[model samples]
Target: MKNVKKPIAEELDLFEKKFAENVRSRNPMLDRIMRFIIRRKGKQMRPMFVFLAAKISGTVTEATYRASSLIELLHTATLVHDDVVDDANLRRNFFSINALWKNKVAVLVGDYLLSKGLLLSLDNDDFRILKIVSTAVKEMSEGELLQMEKTRKLDIKEEVYFEIIRSKTASLLASACAAGAWSATGDEEKTRLFHSFGEKIGISFQIKDDLFDYGHDNIGKPTGIDIKEKKMTLPLIYTLQQADDSTKRRIIYIVKNHNKDKQKVNEVIELVKQSGGIAYAREKMLAYQQEAMALLHQFPESEARTAMEELVQYVTERRY
Candidate 1:
């Protein structure tokens, strides 16, 4: 991930400095929590998208910094809240904020982070950036709720599944790229192009994630966690589409009743693999990947464009 962003390493460093500065607080406890979050930050992929889009479209400006930070802040807040909602005890191999500080403190910290992001945009008069991010956040919330609502019934059509992933995962990446483009040039057309590009890449990224759940591939996380949670991912969804009524019922039965049983989970995983689910998902992911690359190719050639294409490839090839 670090190497993938080498084209914008200096800009990323500046982004990091600004991100830390923005999150600092007068309150000692809040400051401590903010510091901890900064220390435990993830890949900064969203910010990378922001910077790369800025460089690709136009000059990287101070507004670009704030835009990137805004994306990161909102992303961090969502992750914090997700940990609380998922009852997760760890994040990226470290203790989660909810685990260390309790749910109440974690929720407050999440709110604080969200407020910080909003204020950053407001203080800078980055209303376009604010609008992009706010919409993405709303879409993300809707995605989660929709996925949760469908979890029990387990009847997710292919189109609805795309909508859910686009909302839940791709929306933020779309916003990051669009916000960067807007901050750079305010060229609405270019912003729209990059926005669509980000959505395609984001969808491919998530499809790859779903693929990991059925494979023995070393993706760091255990396979079948989605099954255990009764979440219907792309592979399982596609598998269900092709199955007979009885087969679908049997699979659902396993998911609903025997999800905790390792053997049953393995059996289900095997069934999905045998049913061409993995192949269908790989085809869809590749299609999205190709679409994203096609969009990238439409832009004039540059190092930034190459890096962006590499990012798309990274999404498909990443093992973890």
Candidate 2:
């Protein structure tokens, strides 16, 4: 299963070369920025999953390449716009496109990526895939709006937070898998099942990411940015829900009213840990991952299924 890594990279490289044909000529500036991003890519997880699924299911083809690359394009677009919306200065420990290139250029490039994704999906002559991807874009937007609507509000519950992550993160992941399965055979049921698996794993991934916000030297980004941004996440929500009145008030005041401090952030995490909030989140994440794994029951035991299982586990163990 892990052996999929090398083979997947080979395919991505070939596909990317074809995908970038004329990218330099027609859109020179955009191409340069995009090329830079392509050079620094961490993982084409969405595309890799689709390719592996196709391989396991039998025969990777143009359909798999089309669907998977569309996802990569959309994910990159989302990251570009997210940096602008969050006013983030850095990403992957580098200056954000929005910060360095200016938001206007960033916005246009993000829009370009989105347009490219749709145009490429349409080129496949599959209206169904286009519809699914379009719906995913809408889902991501609505989820982000919902999260923003809840920001700085200390009373946000765990259920609501889960709902938010599902919409914002899981929906796109599910859509990617669904598109991949559909590309393979258009077996609607199988597509739906992969979608289910992706949705579960995606939500778990985001929840784990939230957990990293309270820890030191967490992954690529700085810790406690959520607190500085005044956004309440699952762990903090859980702590406030279960903590004593004094501790609850103190946590709220430190995060919401006073300036953001690392010491207070640590104390807040301690409160969440002591109140079993961390344990509860860990359980929830595992349950979601298990649900994701269970969805593979419909498929046979094969290398691809094993690859998919490993993908879910990777998200579960993410440090950031």
Best by lDDT: 1
Predictions in order: lDDT: 0.92, 0.77
| Model 1 ranges off by over 4 Å | 1-3, 216-222
**TM-score quality measure for candidate 1:** 0.97
For each of the candidates, the C-alpha root-mean-square deviation to the true structure, in angstroms, is 1.3, 2.6
Model 2 agreement with the true structure over 109-156: per-residue lDDT tens digits: 888888887888777687777887778888888988888888746667
lDDT of predicted model 2: 0.77
Clashes of each: 0, 0
Report the lDDT of model 1 for residue 230.
92
- TM for every model, in the order presented, reads 0.97, 0.91
